[model samples]
Target: MNQFKNGDKAYVIYRNPHTQNVATIQEAIITESPENNEELSLFLMDTHYPLQDDYAIYTTYEEAVKMYNYYFEDNEQSEM
Candidate 1:
């Protein structure tokens, strides 16, 4: 499983590419299910925008990190 430390910045996918949205990693939690399997939920800073506020689910934390970096990092670099 991938681990994301608190305070890492992440981007949530937005419907419009022109209007980018990003969130800061506020918390990470691991919960045990009835099957004794572990699940993860990454809490983000509340975005005032309705569309951007929420937790995004991923099978693994690694996947979430990748998705977050892909959209956020690439865009930031290109802007520079």
Candidate 2:
């Protein structure tokens, strides 16, 4: 398990919950999870989201973009 302290930079591929089709790579900051003192959260888009395994959070923008391209671009082409 990766542990991040406050102010650590994180890169995430964010998909709007209300608009599923819209997605982008966004930078976030690591913060203490408000709901759980023992866990970490990603502060992005004015919201605090608990960091989880399924989020696929990356340490670098390039890593996040690579995953975004694979999921959004390459996946679409492969299905065609």
Candidate 3:
């Protein structure tokens, strides 16, 4: 069974095709079950579509955002 619920929050890091960098790492809501029973998909609440189903699923909203911000910051630091 999937760990995510309909309103659960999650984070997905996707690479930008053009820049080959972090495209988007934002908070998402799980609106539906994942394609596979063992995996959880990222669902954009606004778009009403699954962004991706192959990443980490944070236990809380803060946790997910914190991880995203940290990664983003680390990438920025590396760019400097």
Candidate 4:
């Protein structure tokens, strides 16, 4: 299992049962999911503004960081 720590950036991937469109992880919140027997859930904020919602979770901190960099790499590349 991947270990996720607080403050780590992550990408949430989930398909809404209704729309069936892939959801984006705009934000990551490390917390426990009461419905899943207190298992840790990475709360993801949807990229769709005004409809922001928690989407999915990452198994490890490294995975989360990788996702973050992948999504926002343009900014880093410009700095280099």
Candidate 5:
């Protein structure tokens, strides 16, 4: 089942492996999947990301930030 509809606003936490920078929150738009009608995709950074478990999509910026802090910031602090 599709959790999002076309044109819906969404948020995602992006972490660049090449740069190894802190995770940043990015805003995206839910769009109809070009490959499948039953699924939805995220239009982010001029790219299409399929709405799958591989990418965690949030409904709000706060939610995305909270998850980012939990996974990234907290881990970094704990390592110190």
Candidate 6:
């Protein structure tokens, strides 16, 4: 499993179940991650506070980085 300590950046994509459209994508620092679990409890960067909602959890740090770029960098590239 990819280990992320506090302050490491992480991301999650929220999609609408009915429409299957992206509701929102959140990027945050790794505040807390339970042992042996896929969930990463976090402080939402948007609010800088813990979020009780769905958040992204990657098994590998590389996967997290790729997804972060997939949502952030890809959009930035398009906008330029």
Best model per TM-score:
5
Candidate 3 wrong stretches, greater than 4 Å: 33-41, 45-53, 75-80
Models sorted by lDDT, best on top:
2, 5, 3, 6, 4, 1
Off by over 4 Å in 5: none
lDDT of 4 by residue, 1-79 (tens): 2455444555555445577533343445555554563355555543221113453446545675566566555556877
* Candidate 5 lDDT over residue span 1-80, tens digit each: 25678999999888886887656888999987788877788999998878887787898889998999889888989999
Off by over 4 Å in 4: 32-39, 45-80
Q: After superposition, how far is residue 75 of candidate 6 from its true place, in Å?
A: 19
Provide the RMSD of all predictions against the true structure, rounded to 1 decimal.
9.3, 1.8, 4.5, 9.5, 1.9, 8.0
lDDT of 6 at 59: 43
Backbone clashes in model 6, listed as residue pairs: none
Report model 3's TM-score to 2 decimal places. Answer: 0.46
TM-score of each: 0.36, 0.82, 0.46, 0.35, 0.83, 0.37
For each candidate, what is the lDDT?
0.44, 0.86, 0.61, 0.49, 0.84, 0.58
Arranged by TM-score with the best first, the candidates are 5, 2, 3, 6, 1, 4
**Candidate 4 at 29: error in angstroms?**
1.8
- Distance from true position, residue 28, model 5, in Å? 0.5
- Name every residue pair that clashes in candidate 5: none
Q: For candidate 1, what is the TM-score? A: 0.36
Write model 6 residue lDDT over 1-80, tens digit each, in one string: 24666667766554556875344555556655454334545655444434444455654557776876787678879999
lDDT score, candidate 1, position 69: 80
Q: Name the regions of candidate 1 deviating beyond 4 angstroms.
A: 1-22, 25-55
Model 2, 65: alpha-carbon shift in Å?
A: 0.9
Clashes per prediction?
0, 0, 1, 1, 0, 0
